[model samples]
Target: MTLRLLPLLMLAAATSPADAVPADDAPQPAFFEALRAADLRLATIAYRLTTANAALCDQLQPQIGMPIHALTQYAPAARKAAATTFRFGATIGVEAVVAGAPADRAGVRANDSIVEIDGKAQPALPGTDAPENAGARDAAEAAIANAPVAQPLRMTLLRDGQRVPVAIKPVAGCRSRFEILLGSGLDASADGSVVQIGEKFFEGYSDAEIAVIVSHELSHNILRHRARLDAVKINRGMLAEFGRNGRLIRETEDQADLLGIYLLANAGYDPMSAPKFWREKGGDIDGGLFRSRTHGSSKARAEALVAAARDIAATPTRPIIPAVLATRNVPLR
Candidate 1:
């Protein structure tokens, strides 16, 4: 799956953008326009965070700075629009290449159909294409991730019916992939290597506010919360919010909340925006099932963020790596 997670807000299935808009399923040019806009915004923010804080991560990825879309991401009926808009064949297309990223620097352009990666031919996504095409997209990333981090990826693009060759020499960044689940719930999650967020947030949040949420998820990975929780063997079932399970879960959330603000500042974002987001949107967005004992209240989180930002502002350290990062080697309290 796409691995879009909201640590304490419960898990929701990842849905494709095309799958989410069944009613407006017609092939309007605006469909891809809006999707690309959101994708680019998230990509830009993620690029900033991962690169600025690479010193904090133990693992690294060849940050290619591109988002690819598989034909399978669109429903059967919606594939034509994608094919036309992106010039699809039996291959995936470049959704967007982050400016100055490896892909963009190598002359890769949007809508370019990728036919091969490092001399290995990439076939079209299997079957008629399903909404859950994240695995297929991830496979393509695996091809790159498998390559040596210090080397560049030699790729062949079918542009104007000509097989074009290019090399994307990726830079070392935090080992993380950022993805957006189209028409997904109010959820954001971070696995060790991937950060997934719901596109719905674009409607409710500005790019800065969205950065707050994205930074929070990235913090979860930076802190290695999932692996730690798993190793400790905490009960993560429906009853995760009770007893020691609840305490540990909440601890992770608190750690993420604090470090997330630091990450924002490290990335050149306004750290106070973290507190501003929780103060304004927290009470509204975090209501209903989104609320959890594993997370602090909106008022509490915002206040805490305010205090944290004050500390970050006063400190003269660059990047300001979290001190708790060292304690992660010890067992959770």
Candidate 2:
């Protein structure tokens, strides 16, 4: 998840007014402006990369026919509570599983709750631990890697409120990677390699809310917004100038929000929750004029996402255009 820093207003209030420095000296404004520009550049690059990668995936989708290793964890009790109140609570745990590969065709759903792995009860890990923790998703991936090749592996899960058992065979010639970064704020590359979530803003969010955040970021990658931005930047020589075209930035942001809503819906998440999540997070209602360079006002983002969600909800089964993939690699991990 991307982490967004506390707004300057919030930060200023937290510290002594006497200690407050000018915007130019304080790293927030200028730094974020540069960061935002970098995000724009990266987005364009990612779009091109994803477009190429999608073609590869499509080709390999038939030949390798392997399930993409993916996992999600949800606590039923928590979900029920959230549904009742329309708010998500803390996550209980996540179940790591596979999707889109041969494993899934064997009846694996990413939603399956994992109780044990490799004949042992799964140990609980700290929810606050970084994604790289051994017992987190990485550990699950390793266990999957060590299983016997071509032989279905045993898995016990709670599906449909029943204790169901299943077997999954591993696939070769596939690799998985994720982008990670520090600091907080919600933003995605136009191309979609990285999604930033504001750490301070996540205070009251539930796992589902976080899912919306992740989905928004992932949407940028899927839609190739980043690559489009990069192409524009190259044509205008913005990289050399260390500047950006304001209109282009707004267009990309709007595009990301719209596409993000669709991605969230397709991924089976509540698209409406996205706007709700932002509203609860205090997103700018006035288009974030106070912090225009980094993000638009929480209110503006919420309103825009809500509209996009409405459009997406109305067309639930429509196929999305597969974005072209670029070859540029992501640097942050």
Candidate 3:
């Protein structure tokens, strides 16, 4: 078999899991740059996935159209870091712009400093007394995301030290928005309409691998796995604090893996990458509750992914759900 699943999975399974770092915990200013970079890449991949399957997203969530393609500057310590190599002062610049997304189409480019939105000057940073530019940047993001459907937002940007005006036209997409949490855990998860990825994921995984990870987490939201588990009255708390309901937990993991293959394929990514990522990257991720608890063994999960991809590839129509497993439900290990 071309699948190299066992090696990485075994390595990851054996490593100790790290506790999740709270976002409020402040790190050094130098770390913000990496967090910002990770946010850009993760957002780009997520935009591709969500927009590629807009129809499926609509089916998944009726309110499928709030957040468009745009990323804010990660400038938590912008004021404090001005004395460093970065001389931009407290100005927050654009970190990512999805190709052909509203912001990109509106003439916004990476590194452009957002100055004003809808003719209103931005507010001060959350922790600084310096003029409201930092707060304004955040306000600009909310402005774009919450803009009325079919309405265009007028924004003023400081690009190359010149004031440039742009118009961003918002479009509908899956209701979920993408976010990156700066921490040292290799994990990603979705809650309601939001898909959040850990910053460490970017340092550890390739773009294709990241896509597979995001697709799997996104699958959970699309399939409403969390809601379904709640509906079924699964005692997630007991399993976390007390003991094990390992089988049932593994069932959900299995279902997400199977569905994620279709999502990867539908988004024009290599379905085979799913298995490859597992083989090479799985071992670095099993931590905290992810430590040898509920998930299926690395080999079993990778084999199932390979099998599912093969079945999907043998079909003619682009299926939202694979045929061989359409009537089946894959449970967690």
Candidate 4:
């Protein structure tokens, strides 16, 4: 679930009026294309890395697949009307496709506008008066929902001014989804079903390093941390503000670090990158009071990851499960 750019807009509004650029000086379409490129690239990398540990995902996830690896771009009506070369219908266009995924294997290519599903034209999605780019996604989701697992889903893509028919066969996966949020801040979180990444996190990190962070968030989901904490009668509202009951949060963070290393190794990624990333970027955000409460020191996290890597190397054949905190029901640090 990629959040809209409302937060980015609000951040820009903080600058002085004189510092603000004119409305006409707003970003160009090519800028959006650049973001789209980066967004898709990172998403592709993440999808491949996470799905590499398909067996583990199969064990933990309830529903295996069907949310295929296809990133979408919804261009507005004004942009479509302004283009001189060719015009596109309000349908959504494919921004990226994970290699060897159902969509990729089915011959769907980037820039292809999804026109119809199973020979039926997609109905207009709610909340949009004008033609929308989400119609294709809505239709695709509906098609996948109705189609049985491993069954064929026929779709018509408008490519090169022609409707190219293709059939995609859905397969099983971990059920955890990935998305990129367009913003400058470096952050990511797993909202139960999806891992939402901020684009800023992509900068200054290699693909392997990014996988470490992603795996950590994915670990949170796998362990059902949010749900588990709630079940234990932990007051989430208290922890969200002023760092109350922060030791509990820190315990979860430690557990996530240990499990994240295992996840990285399971996915055939460099597990060592987990500690290295914490040593570098993780150190930059350490040392505030709130940070101490909500998260352990960077050094502590790196040390835990190091131990986790050693354990994984020692037992190469076994499946790694989420770690349980040593002490629970502790006072806030």
Which of the numbered candidates is closest to the native, going by highest TM-score?
1
Ranking by lDDT: 1, 3, 4, 2
Candidate 4 achieves a global lDDT of: 0.57
Q: After superposition, how far is residue 135 of candidate 1 from its true place, in Å?
A: 4.7
Model 2 Cα lDDT, one tens digit per residue, 1-333: 111223333333333346344543433333333323333232222222232234233211111122111111212222232222211111112222223444465675533455555575544322433232222334554555455545666766555457567665544321222232224234323234334444322334465665555555555555455666676653323332223555555555555566656555554567788788778865432333223543556678789887777776677464443232222232111
Pairwise lDDT winner, candidates 2 and 4: 4
State the TM-score for model 1. 0.87
TM, every model: 0.87, 0.42, 0.70, 0.75
Query: Cα lDDT of all candidates, in order?
Result: 0.76, 0.42, 0.57, 0.57
* Regions of candidate 3 where Cα sits further than 4 Å from its true position: 1-32, 59-78, 82-93, 115-121, 124-127, 130-141, 148-153, 160-162, 238-247, 287-293, 316-333
Query: Candidate 3 — what's its lDDT?
Result: 0.57
Number of clashing residue pairs, candidate 4: 1
Clashes of 3: 10
What would the per-residue lDDT of candidate 1 be over residues 1-333, giving only the tens digit for each residue?
Answer: 112212111111233444334443444556566677778888888888888887888878777778787766665566676677777765577888788888889999888888899888887634654453445666777887677779988999877777789999877777777887544667777767678887678765899999999999998898888888888898878888898999998898899899899889988999999999988888766754245688888989999999999999998877898786775566776
Off by over 4 Å in 2: 1-177, 180-204, 234-244, 284-291, 316-333
- Which pairs clash inside model 4? 64-173
The CA lDDT at 196 in model 4 is: 73
Best by lDDT: 1
